[model samples]
Target: MKILIVSQFYYPENFVIYKIAETLQKFGHDVHVLTGRPNYGYGYILPEYKKIKEEEINGVRVHRVDLPARKRGRLSIIFNYLGFWYNSRKWVRKTKLKFDVVYSFQLSPVTILSAGNLYKKKHHVKHICHCVDLWPESVLVTNAVRKKSLTYKILYSWSKKLYRACDEILIGSPSYKEYFATTLQIMDKNIVFVPQPSLVENSRKIKTQNLGEGFNILYCGNIGTIQMIEMIPEAMKLVKNSLVKFHIIGMGPMSKKLVNKITELKLEDKVIYHGPLPSPKAAPYFKGANALFVSLKNEGIVGKTIPNKLVMSMAFTKPILAMLEGDGKRILTESKGGIFARQDVKFLARAIEKIAATPTSELKKLGELNQIYYAKHFSLETITRKIEKHLR
Candidate 1:
């Protein structure tokens, strides 16, 4: 298949979308990526990438488009979206390379919006939009996108049109597929549940470790608005006496704020902040921890979205300690590999202690089960093949 993947973010970084494209290439498929220049969580793109034209990396062709540095404000995000859409539209037109299908990863829906028109009219390329998260519903909660405003309503309508135009839609979880297909009136055949692809091999080959006498908990991923890291300080305070240490590894807008709160709660000793390590290096942290932490905000819309970290944690055979409600809770409880609590500090502390007290042998078995379940459902090998079967 000749596939063109349009994502707001990509490789040389640890995004799930990049891995998906890479996996497809591994399967003897021709893959081309259209992505923004690398931007660290601080909202700034590297100067070197600004002028980087089309290039090939590791058998995959990449077309880099110039986008403004990552800025946090609502206007900043709007401009970034518009900027990428304009530049990418120009690049696609100028290149004149024919693609069988254009697959877009949401976060920047404008990619589908911009390219869909051109593909439909000129090339008649099939369009596939992967809904990583239900936007406006997801972004609107954060201050990044204005909610309940004229601009938001217009964008929401625009998003609906993009969804309708696409030949197919992919979402990470069944709950999401149901919500969009049933509630939003999207066609059933057009929607599919293809969970986030795994980026790591089996953890059995990786060196294992037991980090300390106390239970060490690790949370690896973006510490941003949807994650609700603000609840962690109180949760840590409640379990300070346990042999529990919290390690947050990943960068985001709330990293500094989380550090400050750890200090204020006097959990500086209990909580360790190690911002953004390379994805390969992250496996050891997951191995080192006695348990992994996955969470989402309490909002109904956010609950439907699956955090990629949960699947990756399961890949490492690490049991998850999730602080979420709804589908996230069901994913863990039904799997029986982890425990969950709402945002209540006392309840979370209790769940933490429950996992902490379990025998190491039992935890290992739980981890293995988690990994097997994740592999069966969310593995890149399985999901990418499913996607390949569908691509035009």
Candidate 2:
């Protein structure tokens, strides 16, 4: 099968689309990627990727479209989205190559999938939209736009059209099925639950890092408002044990605020910020940790979502210390992977203390169970096969 992946973010940006494309290629499918140039994180186009509009990397042919450099303001964001959307639509219309299936990675903004939708309509091919984030609801929760505003109404109507236009929809969270069915009036059978696959290989082992003699808890992902990473430092202050250390390894908008909070609380030693590390370098920190931490803000939309870090943490076989609810909590509880608490400083502190008191042997058993569950449900091979069946 010849598959074309339409995503705003892709390889060299450290997204799961790279893994999915590679796995598809390994499964004897011809995979092609259409994505924006590397301008994630700081938004500056990397030196190596500059001046090139298209290139082949690792046997996969990549078609890149120019996009505005990302910035913090709303104007900058809109420019980036509009630039990619316009260029990608133009490219898709002009390109002569045909595909058996058009897979759209609808991460956020949801408008990025418009190019794939056009192609699917023109070719009458199977179109699968993998929704990593729920739109309009996410925007509303983040206060990006008000629900009653005209902009929100337009976006809501646009989202409904996009979902209905697709031949099938792959939702990252199981909870989204009901939401789409009731809210968007989409059929439940057309919406399938396909959790994000873990990028780390189960066979890859990292040497544990020695960071003093304490129970190391690691949180390694985006440190943004949605992540609710501030809970870590606040919870650390309430923890009674002196040996528990929290290591945060990611960068986002809240990075400065988190740093200031750490200093304000005088938790320099108890809580350490390692900035952002590449996946290879970040693996050892996760491997060495006694437990992995994940959190989502107390928002209704956030509860129904599962962050990719949760699945990645399970791949390491480390007991999770999640401050989340809904699908995330359900996955943790069903896997017996680790303990969870609501988004409260006191509850998180108590949950940490409970994990601290549990015997290392018991924690090991929990980690093992998490690995078993992850292999069965969230492994790349399993997920790729499931996606393949749908593509065919």
Best by lDDT: 2
* Per-residue lDDT over 1-392 for candidate 2, one digit per residue giving the tens place of the 0 to 100 score: 99999998888987888888888998998999999888777568778887887887777789999889777788888898888889999999999999999999888868888998999988999889988888768788777899899999999999888878888899899888877887777784488988779878663567766667889989999888888888889989999999999999998778999999999999999999999888878888888889999887757656667878899989999899988788888888899988987778899899999898889999999899989999999999999898888888
Off by over 4 Å in 2: none
Q: lDDT of candidate 2?
A: 0.86
Model 1 worst lDDT window (10 residues): 108-117
State in Å the error of residue 35, model 2: 0.8
* Error in Å for residue 72 of model 2: 2.8
Clashes of each: 3, 0
Task: Estimate, for each residue in 1-392, the C-alpha lDDT of model 1 and write its tens digit.
Answer: 88988887787655777777878999988999988788735478776676887788778999888877668666787677777888888777887688888888775454445664566557877888777777546657565557768878877777666677777888767677665655456764468877776677577777655566677989888888778877787777887455778888887788888988988988877888877887777778888898899988776566666777787888888778888676667777767888777677788888877887889999888888888788788887888888887785
